[model samples]
Target: MADLTFTKSTGLLAWPAAGGQWSARSGPFGLGALPSGVYAVGRNEVTDYTTSICAAFQDGTGNGFFVPIYPGFSTTRGSIGGRLGIHPDGNVPGTAGCIGITEHDASSFHDAISNTPANVSLTIEVR
Candidate 1:
């Protein structure tokens, strides 16, 4: 199993939660499901794109953070297409090939990942 997992069939982005089996953020990925495989998550979140408020993107729903996503050593893909990341959906309807937290639970989820110890690496598996 993967430490963090996203299921393309249902568009569910999930990770283990305290006292629970897992936690997830589900929503539509506009472009399509990112290639199924394991990906590394950046330790810190960045607002460079989300807060940019580029009318062409977000449609006025971006004001959060997203962590950079990369291919992991155990990934299933030879190469991932374009840039991949995950962020809060926050009233937005879809994403550009990235995972979006649509259940309005991104705040907590973001905090959890952000607070992870710097030495600890994060990886996500997309199925």
Candidate 2:
């Protein structure tokens, strides 16, 4: 299991002691901003589009919740509720309350975690 952190203020996602930093900018949440707190990145899965890696977020009740990160999609893609994961596209409005990075950076993120066992626990802290 790998623990990751996302600092909303700086739009940075990082693994402690990891070599590089990744971007994870969040989208608007409801009438204001998405609640800032800790979230768990559940089981990792391949996106339906087959262009990025994804994982469900566990809510306070430990149930799968929110949109997953889909860092491989192009900038043109938009959020589609639970059907679509968060893409790395820069357009914040398209995120729909999910974190985003860039296709190139997402590929690196995938490689970083690919070696870990399936369903490895990931912690995301939105500050």
Q: Pick by TM-score: which candidate is best?
A: 1
Which pairs, if any, clash in model 2? 70-86, 88-101
Compared with the true structure, what per-residue lDDT tens digits does model 2 show for residues 23-102? 66666653233345555554375332232222323212222223354323233323334433434544233245666553
Residues 1-127, candidate 1, lDDT per residue (tens digit)? 5678887676666677521122233334544556677888877644443456443233224456667788765543324444567766545466666676664434556557766677887788888
In model 1, the runs with Cα more than 4 Å from the true position are 17-31, 45-63, 73-82, 90-92
Cα lDDT of candidate 2 equals 0.48
Given candidate 1, what's the lDDT at residue 120? Answer: 82
TM-score of each: 0.67, 0.58
For model 1, state the Cα shift of residue 100 in Å: 1.0
RMSD, every candidate, angstroms: 4.6, 10.6
How good is model 1 by TM-score? Answer: 0.67
Candidate 1 residue pairs in clash (backbone atoms < 3 Å)? none
Candidate 2: 10-residue stretch with minimal lDDT: 56-65
Query: Scored by CA lDDT, what does every candidate get?
Result: 0.59, 0.48
